[model samples]
Target chain A: MEVVHTIADLQSRIKAYRRRNDQAVGFVPTMGFLHEGHASLMNKARSQCGLVVLSIFVNPLQFGPGEDFERYPRDAERDLAVAEAAGVDLVFMPSVSEMYPSPTRTTVSVSDVTTRLCGASRPGHFDGVATVVSKLFHIVQPDQAFFGLKDAQQVAVIEQMVQDLNMPIEIVPCPTLREADGLAMSSRNVYLSPEERQQALVLSQSLQIAKEYIQSKSSQGFTSTELASLVRAHIETAPLAVVDYAEVLSYPTLEPFDHSHSISSLIIALAVKFGKTRLIDNLILQVRK
Target chain B: MEVVHTIADLQSRIKAYRRRNDQAVGFVPTMGFLHEGHASLMNKARSQCGLVVLSIFVNPLQFGPGEDFERYPRDAERDLAVAEAAGVDLVFMPSVSEMYPSPTRTTVSVSDVTTRLCGASRPGHFDGVATVVSKLFHIVQPDQAFFGLKDAQQVAVIEQMVQDLNMPIEIVPCPTLREADGLAMSSRNVYLSPEERQQALVLSQSLQIAKEYIQSKSSQGFTSTELASLVRAHIETAPLAVVDYAEVLSYPTLEPFDHSHSISSLIIALAVKFGKTRLIDNLILQVRK
Candidate 1:
């Protein structure tokens, strides 16, 4: 229930929590416009950890030049309420200057896993995410960190980074939360007009169609190309929907599976533009042996 | 001292040490061969910390293609003896496969500070050093990590990386230890022939010349170009010495100081080739305001 703005204050609070019996801290890092997705992560942390730490910083590093860096939503009061409700022990909301005191010269980058999907569309985006998450991980020094599979590729990238770097923390990935209508929850959903909001359903709907197709015995031995085509054709049915990318690749690695081999684990990822708002959703599935 | 090869073993040992009264861990990461410079770092760690952990990894990532990676000197028995003598509590000597079981997909890189000096001469060298050191820091989770100022630019890059990432560890830069003949201590020093070793003294000799010149009040307001020429001229006196680089720049930053600004702290760095052996040395000086 304590809120802190500076890194020093947050560290002191975390230390105090640890000093009083070695607390198992869980961290949930977000760009703070608390939707059901972020809250789900926080609630998961609260359930499993002794102390839950939530960071709400609209990271400018993750946005491209013409992207929504400036227009990224902020709702500190609402976010604080949500954090309190989720039983977060500490809330760290640092200023841009406080997080990045100077122009950052250091970068934490993961290759292969970051070359496709959202990473392909937004260059240097995952580097920014990786760098910021690295800074947050160091600052929080938590036992486990929760990440929503809403940004599935992000979870993959972060997991790869942690494994490759031998970072002493666990990455607990939570299921992506969805609306009653099946639309994936995201802060950027607020950017959609009423008509655009309705059209965005094509994203999750196409993912569902792909999921059913993959689950069907008739769809056995389907190549990535065939699966991608099925998803793309379905999304194009929406007049307002413009398919940015519809990719069917190996999960986490994001690499195209060999057609000669049977698929084991796969992810069907989509990014579609409904007006100026670009929405993304994905479904990870495991094929039966 | 207990020697561990697997990361799991090291982590378990470190955890046990931490569990008992919160011991302050000190880390010394090196490429083995056990020179006096490394001993100095270990000695410093031994005196200051409750437990000292030493890692001997001749990181392949730091060496350029066609460089001396295969020929990199290592002496596990001697290194173990040296660690025991220096009072190191744990020695982590992971095999190449153990350290990098898979191709490293993640890279920790620092810009600006890595763009000059050895970074320029050896491409991707700092990235390798940065990545491995990052891995070691995470695995050990030491209170303070010791590094030799013999590799001054490396110290700067690591310092920058630690600051940027907010790594909860201190970087202790130990002074460069040298041979009685004035050559900087390095594992690569074993490559030098007797005559080449004699000529290698020019690397440190020139640093001494620059240090003396900078200290003599007459050298006030001297430009980097003037300082470089004076040192370069002295280094050229050695018959076998082929000056690879002899430059003067601002300490740590490695950027050239502007003539309009009065110099406060500066580093004169040298890299010289004697026959096939290459040696490097540097001197950091503070001008009286």
Candidate 2:
């Protein structure tokens, strides 16, 4: 696999593939510290695409002040090895200066969708995500781009941006990968202490409990408030886990769940802090017909 | 020349050309009354690019609530004829419903530069232009895009967006085409009455006077306020021409002109109302080294 650090170099390498007319380029954009979750996304891209381009850049724009941008885990050698093992044809590892040599005056923003969940807690996060993804999409010019559903809100924001901008690339959303104990895999997982890591399982556990509750009450249906309270109660039982937000919202549109309507599919998302480490997890509950 | 009305049809036609690595695609996006200025841009694209795609979309997003959106001049037949004569390979004339089938939730916005000149008078105008231009750029995926220097502010907004987003296409700015009477050619010029048209020449005439003043006073650099007052005084001479805005500002940046710094290259822009028709013109003055 070829590794390139500059935009011009990446474009030059991709130019020949672009001109061939027969090859389908797939792209996977990440913030390095690659794990099984990222590997799953790259594997999916490799299964169907003729060329796979993976990018690893710790984007500072997405992190708010006091966020973990300074200590965000990065392993370039390991990341390159992972990409090569996952069948990535080209890996783009751009420096911060290469990605943003000057102050950025342009912003790509999606309204309504970016005002809830993690967006509310982390201001300007989705805007940063949308902008960097837009830059990467233009640079890669891929036929299909892969994103992990672990960051469902990020996926939704990108979907809205692509649809609104009429971008020609297709967004392929891969399923979220989990640890053996059911904790969702995240790059920030490195921040967890032994105790915090053990307590983090409460996030996935609460989601699982919500799934079962919905299954039991599938016929009668449940209010979003009821499901939220149930999940919040479960996480609060874990002494270390402090609930930040546990709310149920409609899928894709992400509107507040309405009790007046019959429940079909809803996203139960949560963010919790175990000690100093924050973790987020979600479950998409659909009524079994 | 092939004329396509739907995005799907246009994409299909351009797909083959996109696959062929050797061809360079050039794009010209317009609101479609096809004046000499637009023809000049298309001709420039044809001279340099292997494929020329012209899009005629009367973007409603760019028009203010009380602006002339409903009555925006459009001539599909004539536009196609002009494009064909100018050697355009593809003409994309999408309907309003086709371009925006649903409410747009995404916006591409530029800051600082958009808060001055025309942006001050027409709020959200540059945002609309940036969004639609972004869509067209993605759809066409052109090697180069052409814009007329006549709408210099629009060109600045687009340039900032392309650079910030790292769009791979090069922006080629073509010189403004003028009539024998010195009026800058515009589709909106059709709205002018013969008497109003005659009076509208003052828009360009004022710019010319400002240029001459700047040239004559080059030794003793004039303040922006001084040049603005000079141009405003000239436009007010015409009985029918009412000065809307006449200001001198820094180029590209469009910042308020600083009197402290010696003028190098500055943009003197003006807008005037002749009866109910509004016309705008500008001149870029550079110091002769």
Candidate 3:
């Protein structure tokens, strides 16, 4: 796999790629510390595309002022190895200065979809994500971009942006990967202490419990309020897990369910803190008639 | 020349063009009623590129509540004739609904540069320009995009957006085309009355006067305030012309010059209303060292 650091180098490489033939380029953008989840995205890209480009940059824009921008986990050697293993054709590892040469004056902002869930919790977080993703999309000019559903709201925001702006790229959303104990895999997982790690399982467990309940009661649907409470109650069992937000909303739109209409699909999202590390997990369920 | 109305048709046509071995597609976006300024852009695009794509979209997003969106001049047949004359390979003339299938939720906005001149007079104008241009760029995926320097602030905003967003497309700024009477070529010029059209000469005349004054006293640079007044006073000489704005600022950045530093380049921008029709013109000057 070829690893490029500069935008000029990557662009030149992209030009060369385009010159060869009509190559379907697939991109997987991530913050370094790659795990099985990132590997899945790269592997998925490799399966379909002639060229798979992976970008590893812990975007400072996505983090809030008081959030974990300073000490975000990054392991370059491991990330490159993971990329190579997943058969990534190119790896773009750009520095903070490389990504943002100057203070960014242009912002790609999406409204409505970005006003709830994580968007509400961390203000301007999605704007940062949208702007950085836009830059990456322009740089890569990929045919299809792979994103893990671990950040469900992010996927929704990106999808909305692509459609609204008429960006000619397909957004392929992959399923969220989980550990053996049902905890969602994240770079921040390393931050968890033995006790915190054990408690973190509550996030996925609660989501799973909520999913099964929704499935069982599919015929006679529970209100959004009822489902949210059920998820919250389950998470509270774990003493260390502090519920930041546990929401039951319409998938992709992130809008609260209108009780009058039949709920076809819903995403039960969770953001809970265990000690210092905050872990998030979600399950998108399609309600059966 | 092939004329396409739908985005799908354009994409298919673009794909066919791309398949013909690394064809350089140049784009010229305009609000119909093609004047010599738009023709100049198209002609320049044709000269440099393998294929030229012209889009005539009278974007409503740029117009303020009381502004002339409904009255925006458009001549599809004439525009196509002009495109063909300029050797444009394709023309994309999408309707309002076609361009915006839904109310646009995503906005590509550039700050600092957009806070003055026309951007100040017409709020959300640059955002509309940036958003639609972004959509066109995505849909067409052109190698280079052309913009006439008649709308200098617009050129500055687009250049900043392309740079900030890393839009892998070259922005070629063509010189503004003018009538024999020195009025800048604009689709809106059609709205001017015969008398109003005569008075509109004051817009370009004042800018030209300021340009000569700056060139004559390049060594003894004038303050931004002094230069603005000179242009404003010249425009005031025309009884029918209402001075909307006449100001001098640093080129591209649109920032007011500081007397602490020696001035190098300045853009004398003017917006004057001749009856109900507003006309704008600008002169970009390079200080003779």
Candidate 4:
């Protein structure tokens, strides 16, 4: 695998690839501390595309004030090895200066969808994500880009941006990977202490319970409010897990679900903090036929 | 020349062009009533690129409430003839429904630079330009895009956006085309009555005086404020001309210039209303040795 750092070099590489023949390029953009979740996205890209490019940059714009930007774990050597093993053709590891040599005046902002969930918890987070992703998309000029469904709201925001801007790249959303104990795999998962890690399973557990409840009672005219309360009640069973938000919202749009919304349209998502580490997990309920 | 109306057709056409071989694609995006200024941009694109694509979109997002969006002049048959004559390889004329099939939730906005000059006069105008330009850039996938220097602030905003987002396309700023009387050519010029059109000469005349004043006295430490007042005084000579904004500011950044700013870094721009028809013009002063 070739590792490129500069934007000009990467464009030349992609150009060379394009000149050789017609081959679809796939891109996976990440913040570096690679794990199975990232690997899953790369693997998906590898299977679907002729060329798979992965970018590992800890974008400072995405982090808010007092966020874990400083403490964010990064191991470049390990990340490179993981990317190579996952069949990534090119790895773009740009320095902070290379990515943002000067202050950025342009902002890619999505309205309405960003007013809920993670958007509320972290201000300016989705705008930063949309902007950086836009820059990366232009830099790579990929036919398709892979995004992990772990950040479902992020996936939705990016989808909105792509559609709104008429970007020709397809967004392939891979399913979220999980730990053996049912905790959702996150780069920030490393921040969890032994006790916190154990308690983090409550996030996935609550989601699983919500899924089961929807499956069992979807035919009985179960409303979104009832499902949300049920999910909240399940998470409350774990002593260490402090609920930040537990609600059911309309998928894609992330609008609050009313009785008129179909069960299939509802997504039950939750964010809970165990000690200092916050974890989020969600499940899209399948409607009963 | 091929004319494409749908997004899918345009992408396929661009794809076919890319498939042929290595060729630099040049783009010129405009609102439809093609004038001599737009033809100049097309001609520039024709000379420099292997293929030139022109997009005519009368974007509604750039128009505020009570603005001339509905009354925006469009002559598709004339525009097509002009583009073809100028050697445009492809023309994209998408309908409003086709360009914005749904409500746009995403916006590409540039700050600081957008807060002055025309931006102050027409709120959200640059955001609309940036967003639509971004969409066209993605849709056409051009290697270079052309803009007229008459809309100098628009060019600066786009330059900032392209740089900030790392868009690979080159922004080629063509010189402003003017009539025999020195009035800058614009699609909106059709709105002017014969008398209003005659009075509109003051817009360019004022800019000319500012350029000469700066060129003559720049070595003697001419200030931006002094030049702005000079231009504003010149435009007040015309009976039909009502000054909306006549000011000299720093180039590209569009910030108010202080004594520390060099003479070459300044751009003198003006917007004047000739009766109900608004016209704008600018002149970039050359620094004397």
Best by DockQ: 4
Pairwise TM-score winner, candidates 1 and 3: 1
Q: Model 4, range B26-140, lDDT digits (tens) per residue?
A: 9999998998899999999999999999999999999988889999898899999999999999999999999999999999999988998889999999999999999999888
Taking the candidates in order, what DockQ does each have? 0.92, 0.86, 0.89, 0.94
The parts of candidate 3 lying over 4 Å away from their true place are: none
Q: Can you tell me the CAPRI class of model 4?
A: high
- Superposed on all Cα atoms, the candidates' RMSDs to the truth, in angstroms, are 1.3, 1.7, 1.5, 1.4
List, residue by residue over A110-211, the lDDT tens digit for candidate 2.
988888998999999999999999999988989999999888899999999999999989999999999999989998898888888887888998898888
Docking class of 1: high
In terms of lDDT, the poorest run of 10 residues in model 2 chain A is A257-266
True contacts kept of 3: 0.94
- Scored against the true structure, residue A268 in model 1 reaches a CA lDDT of 92
Query: Which lDDT tens digits does candidate 3 get at residues B78-182?
Result: 888888999999899898999898998899999999989998999898999999999999989999999999999999999999999999899999998888988
Model 1: CA > 4 A from native: A217-220, B217-220
* Cα lDDT, model 1, residue A272: 91
iRMSD value for model 3 = 0.6
Q: Can you tell me which runs of candidate 4 are displaced by over 4 Å?
A: none
Q: How well does each candidate superpose onto the true structure, as a TM-score?
A: 0.98, 0.97, 0.97, 0.97
The residue-by-residue lDDT of candidate 1 on A179-240, one tens digit each, is 99999999999999998898788888888888777667454566788889999999998899
lDDT of 3 at B199: 74
Candidates' interface RMSDs, in order?
Answer: 0.5, 0.7, 0.6, 0.5
Q: Return the clash pairs for model 4, or none.
A: none
Global fold similarity of model 2 (TM-score): 0.97
Q: What tens digits encode model 2's per-residue C-alpha lDDT throughout B80-176?
A: 8999999999999999888898989999999988888789989999999999999999888888999999999999999999999999889999898
Q: Per-residue alpha-carbon lDDT of model 4 for A216-258, expressed as tens digits?
A: 8756767778888988888888888888899789888899866
